[model samples]
Target: EAGVVQSPRYKIIEKKQPVAFWCNPISGHNTLYWYLQNLGQGPELLIRYENEEAVDDSQLPKDRFSAERLKGVDSTLKIQPAELGDSAVYLCASSLEGFSANEQFFGPGTRLTVL
Candidate 1:
């Protein structure tokens, strides 16, 4: 099997620094989600927010990763004391209306490198 590819746009930081990625979807979209893509794998769902409420966040690693969608619009994903294994692309996506990931518009992901 082939390894997953990395993105061009990136952030380089020390292993213990805090990092945050922001995303603003197209206006009027309802459902929003964050995903993590690592080497040799597809994008993994992190958290899903319906409006200001997070309907599904079971996949999120609560100890280090956190996300929030304020006023059901712009969102932010933060990582505290990031680890080397945490190096990956963070993706933010939104759909017009639904609990599913269908017809979602995705923002350019930011790949993080923990050195």
Candidate 2:
């Protein structure tokens, strides 16, 4: 019955330094997701995993961003050589299934600020 967990909760980095965020999904959930939310905007899916398989990651920025859910329970998102535009909330959410109508529970998020 544990909720999602994230680290640091906040970050400040220069424009070219790398940063990483972590997440642990709810127990017994099969679907995990990473989302990005710019200030004043809704979350946008960066990737989605269904039991260790990355079912959807079309929105992920391949050039400098990457993610993985090796055991399908925990996940990590990395932004290498970060950019000023990368400053935003990196949210992790989980659901029972990939297409479930149920609402996803979100983590507090790692707020990254680039200077």
Candidate 3:
């Protein structure tokens, strides 16, 4: 079975540039999540989706960050005019339905570097 897939494992851009990251969750998984991780810190949930509905997104920066889960399968995260402080890893994770206690499977995150 294929795990989650993410694009552009590494990205470099100047400050105030827009960057987008993509993710494809595992087949049969109904819960998906996006997280942001700073250097030397654990991942912080940015958004969570159960199917096409965004269940939680309070931590997401609405001013510059946006996310979407299309058809309950693939997802995209975008940061417009990214700041120098936005340099971090964007992680995508997925798990089974019914809020299973099993560990979530994470993708090889997209690392963004803002200069």
Give me candidate 1's TM-score against the actual structure: 0.88
Candidate 3, residues 1-115, lDDT tens digits: the string is: 9999998899999999999999999999999999999999999999999999999999999999999998989999999989999999999999997655868999999999999
Q: Residue 75 in model 1: shift from native, Å?
A: 0.3
Q: Which ten residues in a row have the lowest lDDT in candidate 1?
A: 1-10
lDDT of 2 by residue, 41-106 (tens): 999999999989999999999999999999779999999989999999999999887466878999
lDDT of 1 by residue, 20-88 (tens): 888877677788888999978989999988888999999999999898888898888899979998899
Question: Which candidate order results from sorting by lDDT in descending order?
Answer: 3, 2, 1
Candidate 3 regions exceeding 4 Å error are none
lDDT of each: 0.82, 0.93, 0.94
All candidates: CA RMSD (Å): 6.0, 1.0, 1.0
Clashing pairs in 2: none
Q: Output the TM-score of candidate 3.
A: 0.96
Best candidate (score: lDDT): 3
The candidate, 1 or 2, that scores higher on lDDT is 2
